[model samples]
Target: MTPGALAEGRPEARGPRFRVVVETGPDARQEIPLEGTLLVGTQVEGGLRLSDPTVSRVHLELQARPEGVRVRDVGSRNGTWSLGVRIHEVTLAGEARFTLGKTTLLVMPEPTEEAAEPAPRTTFGRALGQSAAMQKLFGVLERTARSSFSVLLLGETGTGKELLAEAIHRASPRSNQPFVIVDCGAVVPSLIESELFGHAKGAFTGAHADRRGHLVQADGGTVFLDEVGELPLELQPKLLRVLESGTVRRVGDNAAKDVDVRVVAATHRDLKAEVAAGRFRADLYYRLAVVPVRVPALRERAEDIPLLARHLFQQAGQPDFPLTEELVQRLMGYDWPGNVRELRNFVHRVLAAGDAELPDTRPVSAVTAAEDLSGLTFKEAKERMVEAFTREYLTALLARCGNNISEVARTAGLARSHVHGLLNRYGLKAGD
Candidate 1:
């Protein structure tokens, strides 16, 4: 074998012996693929089954090593002493000593003998973060998860409303029961009623045999209706009847069958507006929204973008990739108008089209999406930066128009009252 070759027998080659030891507990064991500064894993009984890439600056120091791998002591409570001496955390290697509380064990390159095989596939545990808005939404979800009341999830298309519905179903008592999804938007208006309420034999042109609808199939479980707002106004009454009473009549059948099913309806439409405009039935809106939830758009919680991106990236089955700080910053700062689905499509595109560096281009229009204001301190520059952005936006819109406050407000997409408030807050006159 030649020098610098992957073969171990080569002159300048090193074998895959890198390892890590986290002193968590007796049942402590975690494997994080060498990728970024933060390690991802689950929190078990004793401690977290996780490792940190940023355990020590010395780990970064070792980046210059010819082997492209290094170990260091990270400041940990239990301490990570590699080969003796009281130290913080240590970057480890194959066959290293691990200590949790008082117990000590060895970490080897070969897989350890264990009976607990991991789950076959990665499940999106749920979006987790500390934003207050998200906390409020979760609080609502927790409060309404069990009761049989139908949930109306309001959010733009691609905002993961269906995913949220699935989470609700999984958390409910009927979790073991079927979780049937019906895309109301995708169903043809003519077939929606038959599709949802089922059909008897010889009911219509396409119906030769009797068949149960999604609501019946979801009996004892959840029937998630995506794009509930798209249901035809005329068909709303029948849906309201099903929600009002736990009974559905198949097409061409005069008799109604009783069923026990939870309804979780989601849509991007402003249902209240639809009700006022007489496009949607108020009775049905009230039925679906026993407890309504508004899923915030991606741009609203920019703080969670990096966490979400890494999670989605891992879900794409790529164990490791250089999703650098700059790239994450760019993503966080960009306006994700397309929301979670757009982000997923984006990662798919990245995995398919580009390399780790990922050329200076974006999947969608290059709008100033999410601004990376994460690193700003709580005081000083952060406030100033925010003020600057707000002030400039208002000023630009005002200047574009001939000092017409109403026109400026319309063009800037601000409410008239909000525009007036901004004008007073910034101490700006009409022409000034």
Candidate 2:
């Protein structure tokens, strides 16, 4: 029988007895027997250590009391939260819950043995990988899902950022509420403001009726801002204001409407670099990145390639299609510039043509598409080959280093500026 069940069946004990349940990270479902002055933080000496980066060295202290348990925030940078509201200190009892950084804590009386089993594992999605990097990412996702703080997902394109965001919503308390998706990149710059914040009727030439924006549409749930870095510079502050005050004013409207929404923003760009370059606002970055979770790029966890490829193949309606070892090797060998999406497309192409062998790595046909090299000089042909080789080499190098230019330079023994120049010259952007 579970510990909770065991505790439930036992006679009521008179002393202070409770368990602090960690609901996320590597310690999910871990129970700490509450005692006098239990310290929780990222520090090793902490009574309960949480390795999440968002957690401060010393976050909160829980002291056993006659009435219940008293939780005091130890001046944590992000602050302690309960039911989406920040609190300096509060007394908790009877299944009280709170959040510390990216971790969630549940304060409850000791469970009976029948009820003492660990929390059930949450199944996020098929795209949710089983690799170590992905497992860590999911841990952050699970923790962040329990809070209302803004989240920023950073990764290369096709790393399943949107799917991850959806998983978070599904795993959250707001799951039953509306989940609104706003593709900032897809919206026109002219209409983005109105689309996100809504507008009063007649605000613009084409305005026909008063409309609620995506933010309002997601009032009680989550607003997923996909490709959020692509949002226009002029509109960022407005977004930031909403994040700060929980109030959004429609374009050309004087009155502001309050919205209770959890914001989850994602981008392929290195937002820190964008902020450094003055393209992205520093204030906005901090507000969105309260819990920044970096989705792992495909090549980082190559061991999962077979599983992902097989899943994609099955998704393509060819579950029985043979994934030969040679084909699997080729899939794992290439640096997926476009990540999982690229791999899925490759699978589609293979299925479409019913090709039994792996496609050639080189575009030999493209080189010969001109019908002859007679019109081209040997020097030109040599230059084309050299360019292709250089571009391919750099692409692989960038993938290996998680798109960090400094790491790539250090490993290749090249100057930072030189690396940037090469990337620019070859039209190879980082985080592709």
Model 1, 224-296: lDDT tens per residue? 9988887899999888778656899999999999989988999878898988798897556755765667888
Candidate 2: how large is its RMSD? 12.7
Residue lDDT tens for model 2, 178-259: 9999988767789999999999999999999999999999999999999888888989978977976789899889998999
Candidate 1, superposed: residue stretches over 4 Å from native: 1-130, 355-432
The global C-alpha lDDT for each of the candidates, from Candidate 1 onward, is 0.62, 0.75
Task: Identify the leading candidate in terms of TM-score.
Answer: 2
- Residue 334 of candidate 2: its Cα lDDT? 74
TM-score of each predicted structure versus truth: 0.54, 0.60
